[model samples]
Structure formats: structure tokens, C-alpha cells
Target: MRVRELLNYFKPYGFETPDWMIVEEYGLRPDQIIRMDLNTSPYLPQKWLNSLGSRISKLRFNRYPDTTYRELVGEISRYTNVKPEKIIPTNGADEAIDVIVKALIDCGNEAIISSPTYDYFRVSVELQGGRVVSIPRKKNFADNVEGILSSINDKTRLIFLCSPNNPTGNTTSYDDVLNILDKASDVAVVVDEAYYEYCGETFIELTETYDNLIIVRTLSKAFGLAGARVGYIVASKGTIKMLNKTRPPNSLSLASIELAKIALRDYETVSRNVRKIVKERERVKELLSTLPRIYAYPSKANFILFELLEGDAKTLHKKLMEKGIVIRHIELNWVQRYLRVTISLPEHNDRFLKILEKILKEKT
Candidate 1:
């Protein structure tokens, strides 16, 4: 016999994971490639490389991880300057989103999201039998404060906002976020700051004032631990105390917790790399500005979004792959001509720049 029917609003979504399968089909070796997609950090902090594995091994792997995650919570609290009671370490930021949506929104309730933002928020909200209200961003991919404020209603249980928003690579203003929070204090507002290390601006401080405010963060990007998948949520202790029940037992692995703690301890290493990536971002944007028919948007994240105003983004993306370099080509209707690339090391960044120049010159 078959299982029960699925929820109709549960739409299939595409995640930009590694492309090793495609690389092998094309008869290419892994070492001959540079991946400028997915926005993973190219640098690994030295202390993380040095000690986490051994520290993790000291504990018994046969035992389940600490569901409470006392040590990890302490580290995250120290790192974020939030209290330990306000935190819940998750498997990843994705899990944090899923749990929050499941906890707050009921079937037929609605969650508001600014469009062209992260897809998983929509996926999570819908999967939990909730409707997603889409408010389009401003022309520059900036958050639209008015649109979100007007969209909220009695059924609106959650609002997902991304800073240095994915794909678009720009942040929503703090004042705009404050405005939304000030008016919609009754609804849960999640400001996902996965790229906070690069931008250095966060809503963590505001969580103290607004119990409905939840902040989601990850060790994936700036910490170079995408593979580890460590993430967490911070809010007022009472709010966190309520949502913590929605999370599954042993949500994060032992290694992930230890490693996240290790990474937070070595703030210098990650901070240094973030500084480099920010510099590379500026450099890449300035260089792209000089090229004809291309527009580079200002960003505070680890990646840059550029537009091929005169050609197909997919074609250019495919051409870049032939050179063993990979960048993302976004397919959203609002940004059909845009492509995205992670800021890598200076050498890899140089190669991407030079090859891109060659491709554009040929088009010219």
C-alpha cells in the first residue's frame, strides 16, 4: 500500500549544493576546479583546523550528544553577547527556521517573506501547513518595510527577513527592521543573519527588547564550516524556552557543537578572513563597474551579484564552467540577467576576473 498524500503547498525547491557529480560527468578532476558558487568560505581558521577533532574525540561517540548543549550554548552566548538561556544550537540554520515555523504557525496561518530572499523559509512555512505571503523587495533588492507592515494580519504568525539577503547580496536597514518590529510586535520576526560575520551588523541586541524577535545564525559561511552544519537561534529566554520544545532531541551532532565552540574561540582567524573577503568584494565590484553592460551590486556578504545586461546569464555560466570555474546563475524573473560568485582567495578571484574579462571582450 502507499503512504498518505502530500501537502499541496509543499513545493519542490532547489538547493545549490556541491556539483561534483556534474564535474565527473564532464570528465574533470576535482583539483583542476575553482568553485565560486554556494558562498562557502575559502579560508579555514587555523585554530579550528588545530583542535576541534581531538576535543570531540575525548567524548564517547557511542553516546548521544548533549540535547541541552550547555558548553556550546555558553560559547554562542559569549560570542553573540546574549545569555545562554536565550539560545538553542541547531543542526543548521535551516533546522532553526523549520522549528520556529512549526512552533508558531498553525495550518492556514501565514508567514511573510520578502521575495528573492532565501527559499527554505518558504519551504519550511509551507511544509508546516502555513501559507507564505510574498512581499517583493525594492528595486535594489533592499527590504520593503511598508510592504511587510501592510501584509501582516491576525493569521500572520511569523516573518522571515534575511540580512545581506541571499542571491541579492544586500542588507535590510536596521531602522527598517526596527519599524517592522515596532508595529508588528505581536508576530514572530526572524532576522536570519547567516552572513553576519562579513557585515558585522546584527539584530541580536534587539532580541532583549522584543520577545517576538528571533535571530538565526550559522557557522557555515565565515567560519568555513558549511560541511559541519552548525546553527542556532537567539531570543528572549522566555521565547526561546517556548520554541526549544519544538526542536528534536539531539538536533546537533557532537562534532558540530565542539567545532562551533572551537570556531567561536578563534574569532581572530575568522575575522581576518572575513576582512579579506570584504576587500575582495569591493575590488570585484569596482572592477565589474568598469566593464560595459555589467552591473555589480554593492554587498556586505561573502559573494557579489552581477548582471550581464546584454547577454544570457546561463550561457555565460556554462562558458565559465568550461574553464573549470563555477559561478551561480540566478533564474528568478526579476533577476534573469544576474549571476553570483563567492569571494574566494585573491588568486582564484584574479582567475575569475581575467576569464570573465576574456568572455566579455569576446562578446563586445
Candidate 2:
């Protein structure tokens, strides 16, 4: 028997799981591991646990979740000031990306993406037989808006912009984004604010003024509900209607929907934790800066992307792994010299930095 040949696009997509996956796959215990990878919120709110308990006992498990996810959409609408009809909830922001890409781009259409951003955008676009045109960032990891606009053409259907970008903790200027929208009226501009809580900046309001803009957000970072897998997109009603068609019926579980409702009601806990993480993030950056061979970037997100001034980043990562401290190494060609570290609780950040400092000294 012969298997059919897979599409050419699938060939470029490699299957190397991130460093955090290896840490978990190795069966390393938490007490022995100081994980600062994958940008996950280190603290799960106590209120989420209470909400989960109430939901497990009270929710009607036999019935499906509200197909439209009305309640969750309403809560997010009230928080974001967008109408419920303009929002689409999904399993995660990753799902929102796939749904939107599928709805907008056909085979052979182009999807423009800013490089050194999230990989999932390219992966999703490629899986649908869409071509990905990369606009490389500047030396400091800033978006090259001029280059991006120059690359767009009549065939370009979508553009993915990750603000306060992943792997490089800086945001694109709001004005630059607006300029792109002005130039490319035919292409959809997706502003992914997965780390919006940490930055407190957004283009959600722009959706009202521009028909081509869409903003995506997640509850995982600030709301501390990563495991629950809740995320949403805000766009004009027409764009949302098209995206809704691509989403699976009742994609969110009843338990996750109910838990998200409870979490939104108690917003104070999420706000407090986000503030704490931002504070701890600055502290971590300052401490790391003083070390002999470290350079920490200023971040608007809940993580820091830093570089080793005088050693191989992979070597440094290995040393940390041996000591039960895990951090993400930036392996992409554009950022191979850097490493991304998530902001955890105060003590956790302290321990990771302490171990990191010792590793730097040993290398010297």
C-alpha cells in the first residue's frame, strides 16, 4: 500500500516541541524544577478553584455548552465595550487564529506575518494552503512597517501582528499599525493582544472605525485560566459572522464556560495577580541586568527576553536544566542569541535568577 504525498507546505513545518515540553516529558517533579518557559502564568487564582468546585457540582453536564457562548461573550463585551455580536469565543487564541485564517485565506492566497513573532500564525496559514510572506523585524526586534506594506499586494488576505511580541518583549507602535490598515484596505489586520493585560494597550477601539481590523485576546494570561482554554476575538459584525461559520459547534466545554463566567465576576483577583507579576518582572530584569554576562530587554508583557553577553545560549540552557531550572532558548535564526523567561511568583523568579547568576559566573 502507498500513502498519498503530503502537501509541500507541511514539509517546512518541523515537529520540534518547545523546551518546556521536554522538561515535562522527562517527568521532572515541580520541587526540582524552576520552569520559566512557555510564558504561562505561574499563579492559578484561588477563586478559580472555588468556581471549578461549584461548577462541577452545579452545571448540567448532560447538555452541550451554549453554541454561541452568549454569556461568556456578554461578559467580555461588557469588559471590552464591544457588542456581543462582534465577538467570537474559541478554545484558545490559537483556535481563533486558525478559524480566522481559514475564513479569510483561500489556497494560494498570501498571509503576511511579522517575523520573530508567534510561529502558530505561520503554521495555521500554511496548513490551509496559504502562502506566508515574512516581514523581518529591525535590529531591536521592532516591526518594519514600511517593509510590511511594501510586501502586501492584491493577493494578500491577512496580516498577523503580535504586539509586545513573543520572544522579543516590545510592542509595535499603535500609529504604525493604523498606517498599515490605511494602506492595505483589502487585507485583514489581526492584532493579537495575548499579553494585553500586562501592557494595558489595545486596538479594540480601532475595530469600530476600521472595517479591516480584528483584535484577539485570551483569558489564559491575566485571568489565570490557561488550562480552561478560553479565548475570544473582536471584529466588525460581518467579519465575526464569517468566522463563526468556521468555528465548530459548541467548541467550548460546559465546565470551561461556567468557570470563565465565575472568573469574570471576580475580576479583582486577576487584576491583583497581574500587577504582582508586572512588579516581579521588573525586579527580575533589574537583577539579571547586574549579572556579569546578561542583558535583559524591557518588556510590556509578563516575561523577559534576555541574552547572554558572552556564552552560547544553548550551553547556558543546558546548565540551567542540570540544576533543575528551565528557561526557553530562542532558536529561531533571528533570535538565536536570546532566551525568553516567563515571570513567576517572587520566590520562583528569585530562585531562577539565583541559579542563572551562578551559571554565568561559572562560564566566566
Candidate 3:
């Protein structure tokens, strides 16, 4: 089968191919599975489910969604304290990334990204024919702000920053983000806050001060609406208007729009779940630290990243799966020693730790 050459760029993601097979071989039905690999919310609000059921039965399926999704935009506006005209919702935050890259990036132009961050930023930029200039983070998993500043040049068109960065579980400093914006005045800066609810630190306020700043958020993470695939970008009204030109009309489904509205309405439930996850995250860290060979990093997100001091992470991951416990194993050369596990329900968390302890004791 002939495929687009761009597919070659994704070869480094070794998990993409074998991940499904692992699930199948282990009889890991989604419902039966203890899924700590994806960092998904364990609880979906009852309100969203009830609303979706009623909307499906009452809404017109034959007709297309509102071309602009203006009402949904208004809800997001009120939620974020940004004007409706300044927000644009896409199929998901992933699509929002594609839209921004297409709108602002040109062939041979460059986008700056901090290394060992989310892999999608590099994928999207390369797919759009832009050069990816990586600035490696400090050993402590913080952005190398000085290195990023030095990398910007005339061809630099965009910069992607992932806060509480995926897998790493740490946040970028607000002052550092402001400094980058101050120096890279000519480039567009995208702050991806997919885990915003967990950290509660954001640069959405900076949109008022800098026209080049853009913030991307998704309902998939903290809101437990990943299946709805709703995500949005916040920017100045002018930038949003430009993004709309590239966005396909009626890109979101009627059901997704309705569910997002319902999710927003029940913000209290979401907040409660966030508190549970935060509390459980700290407990998970404490337990993992006491295990014989694990060194867990401090986190602001719903997941923890750790390293095995005496054994290979890949081996540990395989051993866990044999017992039906699943977590992410970081096998890339840069982060090869690390394994990331989501902060799941208390019982699930306890089960994982118990199994991990057994494995370490056997090795010793």
C-alpha cells in the first residue's frame, strides 16, 4: 500500500502499532481494563450523558450542524471569561493544532518546541512542511527558556508550549512564558493547556497583552468528554477570525456541541473530580516513592512519571501487563528509563502499586 511520505515521520512512535495487539492479547476489554496508559478521566458526568441522550432523540440528524456553532462559542466565552469572537472550537484540540499550523506556517518556516514534550507538535508542524527546531528542557523537566530564546530567527513562525507537559507532568513557569513572548515578538506562541484543570495556572490572561499569544484547550482531559471530541482555541478576535477562514464549516457534530454545553453547565461535578484526582495523585506519588526501585517525579497533572532504579521500565511494564495492569512505558532514547502511569481510582492505584512491589521484591 502506497502511503504519504509524511507517514515516515511518525515511525518513532513505536507504541502506535503494537498497542492494540497488547490490549487484544491480554483480553483487555475497555470496560474490564484498568487503563492507566491514556490519562483519560475515569468518570463522565451524568449530566453530559443525560443531555446527549435527549439531544440525539430530539435534534435533526439529517441536517448539518450550525455553520459557526455560535451558541457553543458563547458558552465557551462565558466559561473562559473571553469574548465569543475570540474563541474558535474545533473537532478536538488536535485539529485546532492542525488549523493553527496551516494558517500560520509556510514551507521552510520554523516552529520552536521544547524537547521531551508532547510529540504531536512536531508531527503537525512537519506535516505542514515547517521545520521543527527543538530546544531541550533542563534535566529537571523545566523549559530551557534561554535556549528557546536563542533558537528564534527570521524564519521562526510559531512556538508550541505544553504546560504540565504530557508524560513529564510539570508546568512551565508563567514568568518564563512571558519572557519568551516579550523576546519572540514576531512569532506566534501556542500554549497547549490540555491539562489546565489540574494545574490551575494559565496564560489566557496574556491574550489581552499580546496579539501573538494563543491558548488551546480540550474537554477530553479533565471534563471526561474525550469521546465527544470537542476542543477550542482562545486568541485575539483578529486571530480567531483568520483561523475561521481555514476551519471547515460545520466541523463539529450537533451532539458534540450539546454535550459540551451540558459539561460546562455541570462544572461543579468536574471540579469535584479534579480534587479527587489531585488528592489521589499525591498519594500515588508517595506510594511509588516507597517502592524498592522507583523514583517518582512531582506532578501537577493527573499522571505520574517515574524511573526504575534497578530494573528496565520496559520489563516492568511487561510484567504488569501479565497481571492485567497497564501503564505507559517510555522507550524513546531521551526518556528511556521512565514509565508514566495515570492517577486512577484509589482501588486501581493500590492494585498497581501492590503488583509493582511484588515485581521489585522478586528482582531483589
What is candidate 1's CA lDDT for residue 154? 86
Question: Model 3, range 60-163, lDDT digits (tens) per residue?
Answer: 87999888788898889888999888899999998999999999999899999988888888888887888899988888989999999999989999999999
What is residue 133's positional error in candidate 2, in angstroms?
0.7
Q: Model 1: runs farther than 4 Å from truth?
A: 1-9
The residue-by-residue lDDT of candidate 1 on 206-267, one tens digit each, is: 99899989999999999899999999999998999899889999877878778888888888
lDDT of 2 at 333: 54
Question: How accurate locally is residue 181 in candidate 3, as Cα lDDT from 0 to 100?
Answer: 91
Task: Select the stronger candidate by lDDT from 1 and 3.
Answer: 3
Listed in order, each prediction's TM-score against the native is 0.96, 0.94, 0.95
Poorest 10 consecutive residues by lDDT, candidate 2:
4-13
Q: What is residue 208's positional error in candidate 2, in angstroms? A: 0.5
Q: Local distance difference test, per candidate? A: 0.87, 0.85, 0.88
Among the numbered candidates, top TM-score falls to: 1
Give the Å error, residue 245, model 3.
1.7
Error of 3 at 241 (Å): 1.4
In TM-score terms, candidate 2 sits at: 0.94
- Lowest-lDDT window of 10 residues in candidate 3? 10-19
What ranges in model 3 sit over 4 Å off? 1-20, 27-32
* Candidate 3: residue 341 lDDT (0-100): 96
